[model samples]
Target: MSPSLTCTSLSFAWPDGTAVFDGLDAAFGPGRTGLVGVNGSGKSTLLKLIAGELAPADGAVRVAGEIGYLPQNVTLDTALRVDEALGVAARRAALHAIEAGNAAEEHFETLGDDWDVEERALAALGELGLGHLGLDRSVGEVSGGESVLLRLAALLLVRPDVLLLDEPTNNLDLYARRRLYSAVAAWPGVLVVVSHDRELLDLVDQIADLRAGEITWYGGNYSAYEEAVAVEQEAAGRMVRVAEADFRKQKRELADAQVKLARRKRYGQKMWDSKREPKIVMGARKRAAQESAGKHRIMHEEKLAEARERLDEAVEAVRDDDEIRVDLPYTAVPPGRGVLTLRDLELAYGARVQGTLELHGPERVALVGRNGAGKSTLLRTIAGELTPVAGEAAAHVPLRFLPQRLDVLDGELTVAENVARFAPGAANNRIRARLARFLFRGARADQRAATLSGGERFRAALAALMLAEPAPQLLLLDEPTNNLDMASVRQLTTALESYEGALVVAGHDLPFLSSLGITRWLLMEGRELRETTPEALGKPV
Candidate 1:
């Protein structure tokens, strides 16, 4: 039978009493599912609940078979050997002992019928592109990306019927990510992954969008999900327009009815004052007119209320994902103006960047390389945060560097305050106004940076850097899309679209880099910088 996972009446709240999910029910069966949501929509929390890492406040999770889970941040003991991490050292030892003619009863018992356990373990590691890592090698010998792959390799060796992975490609390089993608595509059981990686999401059989503590299932892959959402939004917009028209018509009719009633009252009073009829007959007529006016007013009021309710329902159907809108004329550079120059730069870490490089005007550059190929180091050197060990790295114009950690913003300060610190000479009101364009309007601008979600923090940091004094004609971003949701990644792209400055961004996300209209592509390898195209980089290294 195919594996299955089900959750019923699931509810959870954080220790601080912030409710994330309430009475949420979802089910998955025999397919690869991609769980997606905004930054603080509790994607990770839901995965944890399914994996039994955290108990739900109410309801239960049911699984048809064994499960394996890989979290966003994986920690492995540095001293652990590869075989030990894969949970096969003891079994392998027992098999070896039995083969060596020391057939102790305990050794035979341990070996059981699985004498090929070592081979299976090796095969799992090889599938994950870690074949070179021997069974005896320590975890410390591997890089961060390799470590993540190693953990995944361990999970694969278990051969569970259900697999759960959370942001599995966050630290993986392009090659490593491709390996993970292959594994995900070949899985034969129920698999659910929560990730912002577009390529990874494209491999899913379906999308489970978690928004407002509810799951909305979309058939097919990420592209299909996007298309479906766009169509829904279009329909919703049409409904809103129709509702608005109806509301206006109702208001107009109500106003006209009131005016008519007022005119009738005036006419009746004039007749009564003139004594045009008998006293009793005039009194009866006046009472009838007053009752009719009251009824007309009540009917119009009811119609208006119904129109408003329809308008509210239509508006609710529309999504409210805000985009960053800003005019950065000060950041604009004139044609042929030099922004940065690097001449045979050598980083402090012994990485050599050969030859001279120059960026002029509003050129956009994409820096691509393996994990330790000095892309971040080169960006830091250009930003003047690090001095090159040999040749010179200089920026002719004002530049700002946004590191992967996003440590540019002060945690204790409000978003507006952080912007103010960077643009010291700008007036407070002006700073707040600029922040509103970045989607932090009024009260939102006053939110402390420490309390912001991943996406919000990124926006705040970008605002601070772009709105800084002297207007940063050159911008340097290191792995800017790392740890960001797809929505946040799109937001970053929108913000960059408004920036008229020279940009150098180091990232492994090819799609995002392509969206930025990168004018130049530089590959960092062998401690040297070589110009390459996106197509060339996609080929075997």
Candidate 2:
């Protein structure tokens, strides 16, 4: 495939002088490319540079054809009509005017040679699962996920030769994500997407991993990338072991040389004091001994230095996969202990729970639903953050709620201070000791919450909720994995694995929910909650 988009010697930095990319070079051809990396690896920044949304501090971006870009956050004008948002309002109007017997030259010019604008636009919308949203409908009438699809549909209608999407699946439901995945898989033009969606990435032709301001290309999709990385890590581990052995051997040799040199110096001094030989002869012997000892020491020292350098390099080659380890014995709920109960619960949006629903012990529940299905409302009601319109929703055990927006954290406070607020009266040292397990170490815990990246913010919020005082025995999370990169999601899974509590997580991510060991699956549909099975999720359990 020939290249359609390319960045040469690209460099960018925030106004605070924090460098994101320095002298980076990348290219994308007429095939889907998944750009992936950790939270702060500058994946989105690179996309913005390619899309011309951000000006690079140096170098240039070259594109062979027109480019379309979808940003991480899609915010359309709520008052705009769907047709206007799709960039076809004027063309459609011209076609309508021509149909109404107004043969104005301007209308003809606007209509152009391709006259199937409306049909094509509708088709694009339908392909993205937004067909129900008619051209006249206001943007505000749709949900967040619908808005995302709508924007994507607009981009598709433009038919740009190159497309740049930044975390395009951030708020999409499973069905919507599938639609997007299909569109990406079918894209014939150059496509470069920065995302954490595994399924979406798996649809791509290749994976571009951004790390430390550089991009490493992999031959296939995310699964292939993982397998390749695993092999590389294993080899790197062996190199580390070899380097360590070499370092230790060099240290031993240096120690032995130092010992011999010291003994020879002592013997020479004693011989000189005893005057065993002539003074001139003793002096020459001492000089020669000193030169030989110096050379030997230098050689051993140089070898030790080289060995240490090799060890350091080997260690750096291995990936850091440290998992959070914490004991939450206080959060345990014994069997038969009621955690929560809902009786004829009616949420604010008219969504209701049918019959009596009871949660006991440390049961893990997966709350799966489409966008605008009132999942968040139900969770809020259960957490007592929102009162039900009618009927009862009660929690017998202490509970904490982690909303999708992650507003639980105080942006003005440092990460440590936020945890301290949650665990009131707890010692700062103890709070920091626990925060370290969450990957916030030393000065990192002192970083203001406002300065954290999307992934970092989620981790801090999760840490606060899990480490809160009174030890919540029931945790209600609303879309807990939203905006989290794969690594952060793994860390969350590790952290939750240690929690001995009841969990009700409302999310569309089936893989994440499955990883949590969900014992029960609840589907929220038609204004009611119904029991479902893992097999019904359409993915292998």
Candidate 3:
């Protein structure tokens, strides 16, 4: 009834606080507000702050109604059953019994005619395309997509007035994703979703660009935001160019005048002989004095001052353009045929087969698959991490593997030690420099491998991979963008695309993979690996 939520001058940070939001202000009434930003800009933190579970260092957030938050990673208390987790028939009686205190008592009374938790859960699950799931199944045993769907269903069951979702579609299949979008589109409550999925943004009415400790409102969807931002960026660029040009012109004039003065000074005494007469000396002095202090001279001084002001404004207005580094190197490999190839390879887990796998790599190939499809097991077989049940995985080229988790690095050793151990013969300085490029600079490079965030750890693993004399001919990546923010993902993508060798990576970020133009794909169904197109395997994350 009242405004759904209100936030004013809200600012927050940790004790050793990274000042995330500073004097932030916004309001959420009854519409979709899409939150967009590069990774680590504090989108998640802001959501938590608004939910009141997290306190802000400054300002306030007041909510008038109940809210539901769905984080990207849904931690299903693995011990809970599907029916238990879904609040199926088993939980409805309790939900209704608790409804004695609710404002929507009439609606509950109408619906409470039956303890139809299964039917209700089914209806919600159907909306997320997850109705087919067995009610008795364990939530722990469910697939990533299913768990995600269950969470969505749970959120809907409560029917909160405000929904805050982080990567809401992380566990959805294509159809499920579409359904989620449809639900969001039809919903009357306030919705705030933080996601990189462009398709999802289409349903949102506005975008809140969260960056540098503030939220900037942009009307309409992602496209409109892009267009408007483009114009703003162009304007900034124009200002910079104008300022630089004026500055350069003034500087050039100043240099020219100084040169002229120098030339006259050098020639004045000689050309106009003072010894010839007092008149000649007086003439030279008069010429020099007039040139030194006229309006033109004053104008040059004014121009210099104006130029500096323009330069400062230009610097202040420009925003950094997004750039990523793949750090591709041309480490020669034995020029040969396929190092690893999948020919009509099929993948399935216990006969619930998905798609086919069709891919080959001669260099450092990354074997990628979704959560259950056994990306890790595939990598293991190739690197002897696991034994493949059916398909023959042949590694024709010499290679090293970096798992999603850097199990290779011992926890006790510092990064330098890990580097030295694996990359034996490399100097400490070289290791430090390589680590620095990935943001592990200075003393930070000495941090134990256990201390790194998911992204930082991955970078360190990459650094370790490159430390060898002959870099691996193939690289295998699994959900490389999982923990890295969009910006870091962009950089990693850039480096991987330009990488001289071969690759196999499994990821939900289809837009990103397509941009890199992956050569092949191995679609994972249940346990089977079958040949497929890059287009078919991606989940449109």
Using lDDT as the measure, the top candidate is: 1
After superposition, candidate 1 runs with Cα above 4 Å error: 272-275
A best-first ranking of the candidates according to their TM-score comes to 2, 1, 3
Please provide, for model 1 over 28-56, each residue's C-alpha lDDT reduced to its tens digit, 9 standing for 90 to 100.
Answer: 99989999998999999999999999999
lDDT by residue (tens digit), candidate 2, 343-448: 9889998899978999999999999878878888999888888889999998999999999889999999999999999999789999999999899999999999
TM-score of each: 0.96, 0.97, 0.76
Winning model by TM-score? 2
Point out the higher-scoring one by lDDT: 2 or 3: 2
lDDT of each: 0.92, 0.90, 0.69
lDDT of 3 by residue, 1-541 (tens): 6548788998887788568878888887788989987766888888888776689887998887888888877888888877678665445555555556654555466446555665777788778777677666778777877787788888888788899988876645445666788888987889999887766777799999887877789989987888998899899899888899999999999878777766766666565564465876668786866676465667887889899998897887676534434353654444455666443332333322233333344333333354566665566566666644455566666567766556767778887777777667778887777666656679878898887765566666666775554566666665665556555666676656556666666565556666666555556555665556755544333
Query: Cα-based RMSD of the predictions, in order?
Result: 1.7, 1.7, 6.0
Error of 2 at 70 (Å): 0.6
